[model samples]
Target: MIKLMKSTFYKEEETKKALANFILEAEMLSMGEECKKFEYGFAQKQGRAHALYVSSGSMANLVLIQALLNLGRLHRGDRVAVSSLTWATNIMPLIQLGLVPVVLDCEKETLNISSQTLQSVKATDIQALFITNALGFSGDMEQIRKWCSENEIIMLEDNCESLGSQVSGIKLGNFGLASTFSTFVGHHFSTVEGGMICTDDEELYDMLLMVRAHGWDRNLSAEKQRVIRDKNGIGDFFSRYTFYDLAFNARPTEIGGFLGNRQLQYWDEIVSTRENNFKRFQNCIESNDDFLSLDVRHMDVVSNFAMPAVCRTHESFEKYRKRFENAQVEIRPIIAGDMTKQPFYKKYVTNESLCENADFIHKNGFYFPNNPELTEEEIALLCDLLHK
Candidate 1:
């Protein structure tokens, strides 16, 4: 049976071997040396100075935002702008921290946040801008980066969907002051359940490291420990139960880090296969434009082709979904559509403006399966069924 989504867990034998080795060395899992190695390797691949492993993508967001707040870059009750169409985790940290979430409408073509609307918003005491690379499409990063820099807003990207995506050769997660990634089962990579925060800012990196582990001073280096001791007095250090900053337990298991490291070894091949599948899907869908128009415009706009197509309307979408299902093809909606419609938002968020493009896509858009295990003939058959 066709599934709506499938995990990209290739190299099972290699993964098992890695896990076995890790277990043999250390049975009890906690953020340790292996986690540090994985963090360093991940940061290097993304061209960032530091990457911190966390429990999940949701925790990654929380830790990053809370770190920014602790550093005085962000404050409670300040307005933070985000795309209306995004995963709930993308905006929850803002609400959880008492930051006001200003939802921006999305562009119909790319299904990403509208830079036009984002620019038009009256710049109050806006603390940060959270942008998601919708599905796998790297939104207009150049423009958004320029806007955020000029406005002095903290730029944070939710890159959970677009792990390997780049814009003009610059990686998506690198564009933000800090970015979050998920290595959940079905994403570009798998760690059984893990997430990471990538950034070049030293202070932000240090803050995340501290907050991710119960706000303890233990995470700090000897130099930082000395400074803290000097500032707060050595007696403060003895007060082990004392909390230095508002933080949480967002630590990932050593096993998750081990799995992530193994997965990173095959990232290039995995991304390439996904890209080929994307091209095939694009060609198939474009060939049938007489009846349907795909929302994806170009290859660079998307990173690894996470979600392939965007249909024109809800009626056509329903028809196509039904047709594909009957033919043993699987499809799923794009990122829960417009997130403002979420019931939780009704109580926590205020702006009632219906993002027409986001709403349209929410009702009309669906994604095709992108598993690497599928053979060429299977893809061809799926394409034929989609076209038919």
Candidate 2:
């Protein structure tokens, strides 16, 4: 049966070859040279100063939040504003650190954080904001960036779904102070299971690296550590084990890194194909506006087109889902839609009111096929079924 999301596994032999070389060259697989190489490649793609490979998208978010807290920008029980429609990982890291998660509503159009509601919410001691790029749609980054700047709030983009998406000329991940991405199966690219954190701040990047590997300085260059010690006038050997910061083991495997490195080479092509598929899906559904609704507002903001479509109501969604199922086409709901409905979230997140848009999407929105490898005829068939 066709599945809602499938991993793009092109050039399997090439990936296997790279994995074999990594295995032979680096006997120990935890954050080795291959991981370093992947980080560099990923950073270059995002046009950022640094990238730290992590075990998963969740871990990437966890490390970034922990690093922010270590920097004293956030304290235990401090409030962090986040979208109510995001994956649990997006908010869990905050709760895990004893930070209160203030769930915000999302825009029905973009399915990202609602900037209007964001401004209306009474500001408390919010140390940071965690925003997700819902289903590859680049959120209102310009507005969000300005809002964060004016308020002096730390911004972290949960870019796991919008890896290749861009607003104007700037990429989504680069818009925030620290952005996290997933290279898990069915993402824009895959390394079986992997994630990355990218940023231009060297201090933040270094903190991320330390946190990624158990608060150890083993990954730091001797000169770098020497400079830190020299500045503090500390003894060399004594500072080696001195855990100056709280950290965790979020390191990625060398094999995953190797796969990521290979996948990075084809990012542009993959993104382009996904965009084309999105246009095709839009065209197919445009005539059936009676039953379907497309949320894309502009063409300037490029979407990764990861899951491509959004239905307006639950009844229409069920009809389309059933039709697609009858036609053997697969579709699924958008990411964790309306996370407040989740039991775990109810226990962890605190908010006075629920987000109606997030709840609307949770029950109504679903995704259709957008695989690059799928032929035109196949896409058309799927679209026909969706509109039928």
* lDDT leader: 1
> Which lDDT tens digits does candidate 2 get at residues 286-315?
767634455566435454545645566677
User: Can you give the TM-score per candidate against the true fold?
Assistant: 0.94, 0.92
Per-residue lDDT tens digits for candidate 1, residues 24-140, read: 989668888778889989998888999999999989999998998898888898899888888998889999998888888888666686456686577655778998887677557
- List where candidate 1 sits over 4 angstroms from the true fold: 4-8, 235-239, 290-301
Give the 10-residue window scoring lowest on summed lDDT in candidate 1.
290-299
> Which TM-score value belongs to model 1?
0.94
Local distance difference test values of all predictions, in order? 0.79, 0.77
Candidate 2 Cα misplacement greater than 4 A, ranges: 21-28, 230-240, 290-292, 298-301
